[model samples]
Target: MTDSTPSLDLLLAGYVLNTLSQEEAALLEQYLAADPTLQERIDQLQATLEAAYATPEVKPPPQLRMAILAATEALPSQQTEALPSQQTEALPSQQTEALPSQQEAEPASWARRLPAWQLAFGLAAAIAIAWLGIDNYRLRLAKETAPTEIATETPASESLDYALQPVEADLTAAAQIELNPAELEGELTVAGLPPLPPEQVYVLWTILAPDAPFTADSKGAILTETFNTNAQGNVTESLVLPEAYQTLAQVAAIGITVESADAPQAHQGSPILLTDL
Candidate 1:
């Protein structure tokens, strides 16, 4: 479609053989419109062909004619016997050379028939299946390890059931303590305590004699073991009276203290919450 010259070999063959298709002829005509070089080459080839055919034809000499005539007369008996013998002798050598080539070509021809894209797709699918299997295995291992982590890290005595109970200090600042006559067990609910620091907890204490508590050591006796507040700053726990004070219990109090997680010693930290029960 551009102004490039058409192929000279195609043009030469088509012109000599007179076998140009319609499209090829049109292309050659388009090139001739602008390509003077191609036109000159075509003209020169035509002139050379014409000059070759126009050259004189030479006649054979009389002796050469006599020699050809004698050879032609002897050819019939030679063809009847000699040609068959030569052909029979050449057949086995031809077959021997061709058999190995045919065998070698069979495997190569079948190799071309194999589907390259299908093999690539099967490999990709196998890789995807292996990756998914590994991912599922890791997920199952994480699921099995979660409960063990929770059991080891969480406190043993903390009540999971009363996790939502409100604290008593914020409920009533001066609530009176009422002794339970039937049994020496009671529940303590305290709320609005500030969130406990890390490795610190709150302990419930009983004031034995409010009028006689005068020293730091005799301020109050610990009633129940200490426990950490939940993240919501509420403490709810059960209290059991000490055997010595089972009948003589006067007042129960709740106090918040910062203490170590293991073998808590005493209320050594600042008290942020306090209430009489």
Candidate 2:
């Protein structure tokens, strides 16, 4: 709605905050009486405001209320005389006759008639309070309904299989790999290998059955994981496969490659030990 149009939202907000002029409050009450949607919105706002204040509330010190009351009493009174009461139609100085009073009188024109400064101050105060309440409500909600982090536990290995034996022409190594299908983890232990420079490491490669969304080289190869051997020329590692590569059952072959430390993720070196499933 345009700013010029009277807003049901403004009326609803003021009603919830108890700051509406009597006329606006009455109008809002009448609107809500007939509109369930509007009533729901107002109720939701009121519930949020209540939830924000309900918890983490501490009572003020015993004397705080009394002191505040005393201070307010001591202050000079501003003329509570309402703004020029709504214009009254002039009747004959002496009415020819009296009419019976009706059940309700038209409400006096409110806030619209207040001085400019009073209107501005009231608006500023209301905005500040509303912003504060909204911020607090959000913080409380975040604290109570935060996402929980789930932890994956390692599964027990069913068996350790010496799957691949390196050829003597390249380097002597014994490869025993433990498979934990439940956790999608593999523990690879390579012994009898000679460790030389710090800039080199062993890379494990696997050939998956060519039916997945995985990127492979011309030789249909995918890097499983990489590990650096310890100073004793031996390496043991528990490798974890990402969700996409967890299709271990679909792997056709497992192999090991000697890759330089600076080698790109795409494997170019040939396998030192390779064996088909």
Candidate 3:
């Protein structure tokens, strides 16, 4: 039969979370198998759900798991009483006692229940909880594994000015710098560069030659007037020199310097950023 029902967001949510009945689930599965769009929607919903789960799991207190288990164990005894005969036979006395109170109080009601359906719902809930728990554990694990020195983009940009200005070394640690491939023929975008002091501004340098002690003056070529940042704090200018800088076999590295705004001078301030290009 053609599906005459309108697309239901809640139904889709139920399907992704595996809360649908077998018939409902089977219908959804069949529809998804035949419809690529529906399948994609389901995938997107699942990804979103997983991501949501990850956020909450990152710092779940130790008591959350115990609470979930406690709630699951508290399901109406009427709901769980009629466990399969085999389960009843195999269960220890302690285990039977620990079964939800509803199970004991409504044994007869449970005895008439269908094992498959009950098991399905139980399994679904268990799987959901497990997914949530594991996702949370993994998030916490990732946070723990991350290096402390790594600067995140959002946090670094909050208080900084984006105008053509000098930034301090303390602030540079939190500023991100971008390079357009078309504007600067270089690899690796340097993020989190701070501004220079009032009398000093930043100059981008290309080290075309590597001298013995590796002084900035020993570098063969200089990239000029190519540094710019926008209000949103993105680097819009090019620090790359002409094509000649690319041919030098011994180019040491790329370096940023603090210099007087209008003189043929080179004073080594704190290296704001550096990379081999």
Candidate 4:
């Protein structure tokens, strides 16, 4: 291959790491498409990369360097010491002649005779570099593909506040109801109302509009809650409105009536305090 063209292994590594330039990636794709079997190698590399990433790094023991060095330093002397005995065992003329020829045939480069530890360290360093490359490449790809969230201010819920009007203009009783349509909840605040006896209680009612959906009550009034006033004839109660309360369009009005505490849903009495929606 020309100097400009990367070897197959280099191209595969670059492709797996996603570090290939446009032209290099195109070249690799062409080769991969031509040989469909190359996909298996790609998958293997991907799996290996994932495994390496999932593996936790472990530090070498402190004595590892000393052990490796000691072994390497002792190798030459141990080999030299064995040479005389080896020569004696090969005393036959033919065998001795073959030993010298074998030694001569071996590579003369010092790199070929490098200590095992040095070769292993070089390989470990290369793998570490490859892992780092893959990790960084994956992080960059994630950042590029990740969806960005836009900050938005949510509009506040629509709150409906109504004042309860006493049935008799001379009555000093006052009350108010605040409803949150979004949450389908409301609060009832009342003061100066006359306290009822044990047999009677104040029943809140929701009067449905004429076009409201079918309800259990034929009178179009939903019995909301039954509450008792304090000794001081004042009460503040948090009320959970029904789903129908979400839209006032379905409600004709809100009212409070003095009903029999045993059966508040009977709604036998007229509204003592009422508010038209």
Q: For candidate 2, which ten residues in a row score worst on lDDT?
A: 148-157
Ranking of candidates on TM-score, top first? 4, 2, 1, 3
Sort by lDDT, best first: what order? 4, 2, 3, 1
Which tens-of-lDDT digit does each residue in 3-116 have in candidate 1?
332244544535554655555566567667776577776787566555444544334346545654555555455434422345545678766565544223322222122244
Please estimate how well model 2 matches the true structure, expressed as its whole-model Cα lDDT.
Answer: 0.61
Candidate 4 lDDT for residue 30: 75
* Of candidates 3 and 1, the better by lDDT: 3
Clashing residue pairs in candidate 4 are none
Query: How far is 68's C-alpha from truth in model 3 (Å)?
Result: 95
Off by over 4 Å in 1: 1-181, 210-220, 248-254
Index of the highest-TM-score prediction: 4
Q: Which prediction has more favorable lDDT, 3 or 4?
A: 4
Q: On residues 90-187, what C-alpha lDDT tens digit does candidate 4 reach at each position?
A: 58877666664422332121223445565444345445646556666787887876643211221215677999999988888999999987798899
Query: What digit string (tens of lDDT, one per residue) describes model 3 on residues 147-186?
Result: 5434452233222222222344454433233433223343
Reference-based lDDT, residue 204, model 3? 65
User: Which candidate gets the maximum lDDT versus the true structure?
Assistant: 4
TM-scores of the candidates in the order shown: 0.29, 0.39, 0.27, 0.44
Candidate 3's displacement at residue 148, Å, is 44
Q: Each candidate: what lDDT?
A: 0.48, 0.61, 0.50, 0.71
